[model samples]
Target: MTSTPTTRNPPTSTASSLLSVEGLRVAFPGRRGAPAARAVDGVDLDIGRGEIVALVGESGCGKTTLARCLLGLVPPTAGRVTFDGAPLPRSARALKAYRRRAQLVLQDPSGSLNPRHTVYDVVAEGLRIHGHAGDERTAVAEALSRAGLRPPERFFLRYPHELSGGQRQRVVIAGALVLEPELLVADEPVASLDASVRGEILALLLRLRTELGLSALVVTHDLGLAWNIADRVAVMYLGRIVETGAVEQVLTAPRHPYTQALLSVLPEAPGAPVVLSGEPPDPSHVTAGCRFHVRCQILAGGEAERAGVADACRHRELEILRGGDAAQVACHWARAEQPAAGTGDAAVGRRPN
Candidate 1:
């Protein structure tokens, strides 16, 4: 079958978006009359061409699900995902073509690479799958070089077990690069590597972006990683983005309590780590009103009550952070704090609550 393009353009994104998602939701069915588990609920995100956006959150906060949705590996239950100003293709052929333009780098390299396949075969697999008409050896070599594997020919006969952890990851990246994707959705790209190797992998990603003009959506729980590479950071809680802004602004001066609690634990954090009580935040069983209300330190620590916004905090569901350059926090308490600091509602991108 021949590949085709979809002309559908969603109303949710700006023209600058290389990849965007609007109100995206993905849910899994529950047994015995139970409500489905919504892994990704009401998310809005964008990654511009040549820009790196980090999606930061703890485990089960839907970071991976959202990444999967963006790559079309998992379909959203509601809302839409767009690439290059076009909606995700519905046809198989179109999807295949879209995938060639956008690729994924998984968290674990050992599991992602097959032990039986040589490095040459692994990197050349995508070219073979896509039926590349160009010279295979040259394409493979260039990809390997781009991924930082020096003298790419030396690794051609190496198996997965023959390489170091970082080398295996570079091979995985080379595999994706064989297709010359425009975007990469890297899920915890450095988590599995040694501390020393982590920086190397990150540097490789940054270099790729600069040299190839590639866009990336880096999904990780490490704010430190986001600080190092991402131009922007979106801090997620439960299943929604609670705060977003330029990486420096959001990481240095996070407004959402959820974000604050997350950053407090950093070794260099000015304040001590916030010890959160009660159950962990989960998207599978989201409730009405503010999903973070029950666990919110602002409410529990009596800050919201003192600000006279406790009632609103408990009942109002905040909208997604508006896109663009503004540093926004989707919390009533943040708005309340803004007034005291003379920043006002407009400063926080406060929406109707």
Candidate 2:
């Protein structure tokens, strides 16, 4: 990899984008003498108003860190994140107001909901924090109703231990909705729910978008969920986005080796499931060239070698894959005007560790 800080080009916010991340990076100081861990490195993403964007990646791929940075919960080491044409503020008062407009719905309803708090109290906490002066009861009830808890008053006094998994999730959603935020950042929103409950929560998310014009950035490892709900999908690996495009285009016919390997493992996927050899390299010690090169099926198949780009695959640094309707892949061979030698829909298998 090479360094050219002056040449770093971040994505500029588009008019339709409600939230934008421009060349963002977050590096954490390493333990002991280890190198600093690059949790989120050079990620560019855009979420349009009223649109749903899925940030899909394996565990430890830094999707959660990226989401945290977007919500201003963590500071970035480089670049910037903007919301509604304005950069995220640093002042406590301004950040508090920013949080009011951009809420987070966590993955586990049980972990998120306070066990002792009544549904009404849980949802009203945000309003109280923001010093909302409007009718508190009306606001809480409206949020509950919107989150699909009909006859909101019935559940108002019920505690978290009294609600079903789906109901608890609804309560969590209502807490975020109580303030009527413009955007929601949901990290692994349905990971803990049963299959039946997962669909319902996903439906609730879709319904919210349709009815309230709420934009969202959903972080998950499930590609199937991305196809079902997101307008677009961004595939992240080891602190970087390797592929991104409209969900249909990227999921149905992927180009990047990493993206192809991921989609091929879906139960309904057409080809043999690709079992990657091992976990991704440690973020603190990222290898050069493509972040995914070591695990890339295409590279293992000798396609990069045949295409005369293997050295680049091992030594060159790749730029961030920008988000758009048309599919984009960050790869030395795949990005060449000509496709890599003997390229196919997918090239996958076990590689030597």
Candidate 3:
């Protein structure tokens, strides 16, 4: 997205991430017979230095809330978010510093940019807030130019309403970049844009990542989009991470049932889509054994089919392995006969657990 190219800068060591999370949990209040809603229940994730990790799941699965917790915008009832080996504190001073190092690009571009402010003011706000004393003229111009609003001078004085949707969105990106964050948490930044513009923006985010040497956590429900940009993919289910691995591995050979269902529906490689039946179970009313058991096609038969086994046994013999390892299905029989790593065949060809 740039003509006069600039060399990418490596991230400062002080801003790098270490083991980022462990068993994160968040809950809302409940009453009567209803239990408190646990939006994020025991989620474990880590986004290392210079990594692009995508967190994909259905709506209301706590992806956004998890992002909020990561940024310290919301307090976590359980778990910890660490940066560069240090735990993040809920204190205002710690949070302010965290805000500078890690920034969030909201879902709605239009809602993010101020209607009253000129483009220059919108991009300049971060610098002003952070007590930056550099020449405002040069910083604003550079940020806008880097975002591809070239000869940035022409666009500086225009209001948000004057620019096209794409341009306005870029303005929001420029504003975020001006602060020069080490990590960016983009919460479905392209979900609201036109189909044509979506790719353009995705390209922009990727180019910025390469040129700026920035690490990112891209949150979206679209598996296709995650495949396109993320170096690694982490699939979330009912607020927990069900699968994670390199983009090629997780997308092509999913280990988790939820992950399998998601990839099966993708329009990848221009094939007919794999249609799925039933919606995700309600969080409050999630079933015993596994949250997805009700809709899962891997249920075991009752006493007549298998006499010593429980009437309903959860296939829990699977284990997480590195990408290119055997097809690590979360089903008991599949794990018992786990295939050799990189076998390119199913551990147990799609069958009932």
Candidate 4:
């Protein structure tokens, strides 16, 4: 296999980043006395106010774990998360306030909603939780309307079982929005819906962001979804962020090896598919060099060059793993070559063996 790089225009930044995560790491105790498993090694992110950023990675890459850590649902082993220049709370009260400020719309809408409660009660739940009982009815109406459940009165008394898949998902969104949060953490929110409903939910989320001034941290493994909705994209590998850049830049002109391989499998056109030769390696092993070096297509000259590239690769990888950072790469030869725009030859060192 050969590595290739393409150059594409970056997204226009309309405003400043609202949420910033620096050197975030999360670890869980291993079985017995063994070392802890580092779920999120070192991740840095920046989500501009009113902008949507997607965390793209396969299962076990720590996208969900990172989300849980950011929300304070699971305490981080290290690093910090900040919102609008204010540090997140570590205590329950502060955490509750943080949760109010940043709500989550889970993937499974059917499972998330209470079957016994009507859509009205479900949307109004957050209002009551936050002590907004005085105007609960009006708030529910507005939220429901915003989520595209028009004629809110009609859907008000309808139970979860009575609503369609799309309707149920909208209610879940309305439930989260009733709190008037600044950030929305959506974990694969459209993954469980039908193809048609997926587009509807995505459009709703985008519309909500525009109408309500809400920023988002979307977590999904689908590159197509990220390409469609996210302003910027972050690719994770083995519990650490491998690459992050403007969605256009990373999607069309990915700088990291893993990012290239990911785009490879995704359809470049209607019938194209870039298939992988083997499954990803286990994340538990904790390799010494670049976490992706094992599967990377960028080859070094000899054992010494390979080892040197691996070490240099590790250093450069972490430096440019977040948006707004310089676009530096890890591989020795590839980095030195700095592939010309729109050419695979510049990145592949001669050709694949």
Instruction: Note the Cα lDDT for every prediction shown.
Output: 0.82, 0.83, 0.71, 0.74
Q: What would the TM-scores of all predictions be?
A: 0.92, 0.91, 0.82, 0.85
Q: Model 4: per-residue lDDT, tens digit, 1-353?
A: 11232222244342366788877888888788877888888777777787788899888889999998888898887777888788878988888878888999999999999999999999998887777847788899999999999999999999999989999999999999888999999999999989888878887888887888888889999888888787778788888776665677677777676777677776463334434445665655676656665556663325325444645554433332443423333345445455435544322222110
90 in model 1: Cα distance from truth in Å?
A: 2.0
lDDT of 2 at 131: 97
**Candidates ranked, most accurate by TM-score first:** 1, 2, 4, 3
For model 4, how big is the CA root-mean-square deviation? 6.3
> Between 1 and 4, whose TM-score is larger?
1
Evaluation by lDDT, superior candidate among 1 and 3: 1
Write candidate 1's Cα lDDT for 224-288 as tens digits.
88888888889887878888877776777777899889888888777578888877555557866
TM-score of model number 3: 0.82
Q: Could you say which candidate leads in lDDT? A: 2
Lowest summed lDDT over 10 consecutive residues: which window, candidate 2? Answer: 1-10
**Per-residue lDDT of 178-240 in model 3, one digit per residue for the tens?**
888888899998898888898888888888888887788899998877877887777777766
User: Which stretches of candidate 3 lie above 4 Å from their native place?
Assistant: 1-19, 31-33, 269-276, 300-353
Model 2: per-residue Cα lDDT over 1-353, one tens digit each: 01111111122235678998888899999989889999997887788888888899999999999999998899999987889989999888899999999999999999998898999999999999999999999999999999999999999999999999999999999999999999999998999989888878988898898789898899999988887788888899999888776677678777788888888887777869887878999999988788888888878989989888899999988766554334567778776533423533221211111
lDDT score, candidate 2, position 204: 89
Assess the local accuracy of residue 127 in candidate 1 as a C-alpha lDDT between 0 and 100: 91
